[model samples]
Target: MKRRFLVAFLLLFFSYSLNIYAVEEEPSPPPNIGFSLNLLGPIFGIYSLGVSSFLTSRVQLGLNGTYFDTRSVDPKVTGWQTQVRMNYFFSPLYKSGFYIGIFGGFESVQIKNNSGRSDNYTDPIGGIIPGYRWSMTKKLDMLLGVMIGYMYGDIQISPELSFVYLL
Candidate 1:
């Protein structure tokens, strides 16, 4: 009986030691930086530039800027916007593909009337924007999204699309 107990204790101790010494997997490295730019139309032109850094293989943090110009009417309207995003890649790293994310940012709008009309109002605007991104390559990408919030006392909704290139 004593021999059996001694053998059992030795077995249990060996198993416990093995469990403690088992190898663990290392964490994945972060994502590299990326950028994109976009043209809406002849009346509307937009530029978006950003950087994406991987927090993990699947997740990333991004900072971006958007510049918009509209020239449909006699007056030309322009806006400057900025955003920060968190992204998730659908596929593994080193694969050619795309990524999606949620973003929020600040925007400012200004309108100028080339006609020198009395109806023109020079004002500075502010708002919030949300959007998503798709990567065509490691250095180039496209994004589509919207902005809905308050600019001055008015509620505005602006939809935007852009392409970006990493440097």
Candidate 2:
């Protein structure tokens, strides 16, 4: 009976020690808040800014806003957009690795023609985005993704490229 008890105690102690070591080996949790800017927005005549927060170790929620004017390109388009999103990261922590998300938003656009006539419209938009976020430095990350969904009764696909600063 004593031999059995000794063996059981040793096994339990070994298991507990392993658990403690495993916990110590884990990476530190990421920051809770991040600010993001769209890198391609300026080139396309759109300016955007966003904020995101970690809801859980693998989940994050974000809000973004954008304003655009394309008079230089053609169609003389001007618009503003706002969106909110929730993402589930496949990585062990937030703002890293592969992620899939859903977003819903609204946009208002105006187009002016050469004849000086203008058309204005507003629409609600929703989509699914798949992306990857990589660390650029200790506190910066770059995200690359695509949004696919419905807008103005039509299917739309848009590319996304952004940089995030974690705090």
Candidate 3:
């Protein structure tokens, strides 16, 4: 399944390259709020959602929500998180090309322990994310990113994928 997804993504990714060399016009990217998803978290049973807004060709700001609930795994667990993200794309236009960004927020997590005690906390979060953004059409924009940051004061890594409609 992962291979299929990667193949599909690459196909879509390359579909746009054919236009990079064609005649170019005005750069019109998303300037409004964009709804997105964190595709990498689900592999670990984490589900996340996010939203963002672009200020120009080089700046963007957004927020995300993440949740985890498992009953079939060894220990039952439940949790949620919220994060704020800001990014800068080095492209020559708004909402297109490679990017580097930062994020800070908080998370509320809970895990069922063998001692019958649930561990939980709401703590500050921070990270540095590097990614790419692009469009295959006028109405749809996509993002592929990886986040390496701190959560609960611990270093961690996260991969992400998002699709946002231009407004």
Q: Per-residue alpha-carbon lDDT of model 1 for 69-90, expressed as tens digits?
A: 7666545657776777675544
lDDT of each: 0.55, 0.74, 0.69
Off by over 4 Å in 3: 1-30, 39-44, 71-77, 94-96, 112-118
Flag regions of model 2 displaced more than 4 Å: 1-29, 94-96, 112-119
TM-score of 3: 0.67
Tell me the deviation in Å of residue 68 in model 2. 1.0
| RMSD score of candidate 3 (Å) | 6.8
Worst 10 residues of 2 by lDDT: 18-27
TM values, all candidates: 0.49, 0.73, 0.67
* Candidate 1 weakest ten by summed lDDT: 117-126
Q: Could you give the candidate ranking by lDDT, starting with the highest?
A: 2, 3, 1
lDDT of 2 by residue, 1-167 (tens): 46744663465456445544443322456568999998877886889999998777667799999887876765577988899989765555432466677899998878787888888769888998776767677678787877878753468777878898879
